[model samples]
Target: MKTIAGFITACSIACSALAPQASHADTLTIALDYDPADLYGTLSTNNPMFAMLESLYLDDPRTGQVEPYLALSHEMASPTEVMVTLREGVTFSNGEPMDAEAVVHSVTVFSNPEIVPAYGIYAPMIDSAEVIDDTTVKIVLSEPNPIVDLLLAQIIVVPPDYWEEVGGTEGFGQAPVGTGPFVLTDWVKDDRIVMDTNPDYWGDLPENIDEVVWRTVPEASSRAAGLRTGEYDLAMNLPAIDVDAINAEDGLTVYEGDVARIFSLVLSSLDIHETPVQDRLVRQAINYAIDKQTIIDALYFGKARLLNGQVVLPGQPGYDPEMTDYPFDPEKARELLAEAGYPDGIDVEFKCASNRYAQGLETCEAIAAMLGDVGINASLTLLESGEFIGQYVRRELAPIGLIGLGVPNDPSFGIGVYRSDWRYSYYQNPEMDALIDASRSETDPEARAEIIRQASQLLFDDAVIAYLFGAQSFFGHSDDLEGFATNVAQRFFVHTLSLAE
Candidate 1:
């Protein structure tokens, strides 16, 4: 078996083959791993498409709180209703007013299951939206949602008039219209996406940046090489192994920050599938088998933090400091496997994306080796981003798979995956369902937090998944890049970015 060190050495060798390209003075070129499937923000939670779109609310970079962006102000009108006031003079790049009517249209389109398939499960929470006046709109919820503002932050506003004229999402996605600071100018499928500054943007225009291009570079070494060769201004998801080498360069720097995303091995314990992981003991054994700290230190260079629960991260709502992570106990794992009728060993197929997350493939390889120590033979099945997402969303990749979920601002956003009715759910528990359901309409902050805590406790005790660690994103960029900032949700502040003169 190849060691983690061997993997890093291989990556470093591969990085040296990238050729230099002519640099653009006014354009900030970025290297991304995968091409975006759609520019419609409502269809997916986190995507590169958000650079060309603006949401009503945004997370404050200083304080992880959701504040108004396009919408000037918002308040809860009733237990199940919210009133939002839009900022006047805001218009999409296509010259359409981003008023109350546009907000209502965005909410309506987002809440429709047939329109936004990926996030359709969340559509029922929003009952309807009504335009109170030209600047104010009222949104009715099916139930009292505690984190209404955080939920609203995910709805990227679009112009209704242009949407209808362009024939809905498919046509609009080809040429998206949003109120963001950047406008999409050209997109070559699976190659690059080019955007220019939105001159009619209502907010402050970007400084020094005339155009932004996102190139698809699937290899981490290639991305690092591009940054070093000046072919790219910024590289996303650079492996930790190349950080020291990149920083040693004169004009490059690597920035590291802890994000709200959690990576874990989601086991399919549903009764519809007959797998060893269905047994609670086997699941618990899997948790006790691997050492998360060692993986973090070896693969991430101590950049990532260990996760205690499945979804909730520290400083977020429902975070429990008292809860402990499963210790590395291969003996206990073996005993449990033996008790679960697998005396000699058990074979399981582990599926994971090749380059979805930073060091994703290498981490899975390490995990598979660790599982082997406990007499569990895990055959690794690696897939690319597109195939992995397709199978994951449809719940076709069963048994066990490594996946990441974003918590963003609240635990409510992350806990939805544990619900039985969730489209991507692989496990079921009636108690978990009840606790998650109760947290939705919880009005009082303390009460709602307690409910979330209880739900998290249920997931931990049940060993729903092999809880891993909170992810930290590493970006290799030119030292000349200034005011480059990203929120806890991992969204970039494109407007604030500028090049040093």
Candidate 2:
């Protein structure tokens, strides 16, 4: 890929046609690194189509919570039961009624892993659901789980008729339908996704831009170049190489987004759930050998921030300030290795993804050098995201590679990923499991946050992972893009975006 030159904002677009309601054209052409997968019922890649731009649900990113989207209000039936009432008279983009049964079907579909593996985090815990009325749905969790509210934020509720019309899960992916703010027009892989505003959209339309075109600008420089040339209006993961130029551009702005992506170097021992990786001394030494701050500064061009814990963003309620990160210390690393019975060094194979995380391959290479100094012969192997995730959940099959969050979202996400059962490092501890259970069941925010912190401390104590850095979803767009605000956890909600003509 060609290295893109610095940004130069060009006011060349003919906006007259972009505006549907405004005096000028209102189309916003944004760019993504990859195109969204088929927005089928549940199998779509976590595309902005179903999560942000083209969709809406009961999520309030401000509080790290999900409310009701098409649903009017949700009531607590019991400690482990949630009763949701759909907004009355809501219509799908195709003009179908979005009622309670539709919500039930969506929920049921999400509960099945065979439908969407990512949704399994939300589905596995659901015990059952009862269709209380035409507009009301009640979800009963196996336990008192709060993440259920967060899960609803992106699980698009489809019209029951739409699924029946399309056949089933297989058909749903091809002829996708949703009650979101926009309707899919066309999708070309590694190209662009065109979406027209839902004419029958029940909620508020983005005031600045009408239609949204999410493009895939494969290279960081290319993405930045497109933003500068007026070929694109919003760009994700603008190359760190051009941060200042973007900030200084006349019509552009460089805003920070949460990297919600995490990078780690894990050592999965043969036991599958109990490896030499669970050694606190080994894990801490690995962290000592590597310098996280340097990587963030260099790779991110100072546009990114170093993060810790699963909850790194400041806005998230459970961000524990006390959960400090280890500073870089080669000497300390050597000491830990010696203490762990490898004074000279230990041979270990390290694996990472080529393009999974932002600059993941580079990260693995850098980490290997650090480990070399500590007498750990680290062999770096890179894999794509699919094989990396599959082998990780299975354990010992995949190299001790770095993975961000096993589950989607936050602490509730930690339940399945960091829990003892997940075998993150062949680690299993009763205390860890008990704390996870307590946090999941706790209704009070403070109490739950404390338990989450404890769980984090437990994992940290065991050195289950060579904690490297937190995810800061870094992206760039025109400064004038309204409704764009950086939350604590670093998720971008375009529903909050507005553009000036």
Q: Evaluate model 2: give its lDDT.
A: 0.63
lDDT of 1 by residue, 1-501 (tens): 333343223322321221112334598899998775667743345445666788888876545578899988888889888999989999887788999999999999888866864555566689999999999999999999877777788777889977776577765665677888877766676788777777788888767787788899989989998999999999988888898889999999988756566889988889887989899899989999999999999998887888875578787777888888889999999999999999898899999998778799999999999999999899999998877876787776678799876556677767877888776788888888888888877878888878888998888888888999887888889988986666776777688778877
Candidate number of the best TM-score: 1
Supply the TM-score for candidate 2.
0.81
- Per-residue CA lDDT of model 2 for 266-381, tens digit only, reads 65533533534456687778878888888777776554555563333444446677677777899999999889887888777776755546566667787788789778788877
Lowest-lDDT window of 10 residues in candidate 2?
3-12
Query: Which window of 10 residues has the lowest lDDT sum in candidate 1?
Result: 11-20
TM-score of each: 0.90, 0.81
Candidate 1 collision pairs = none
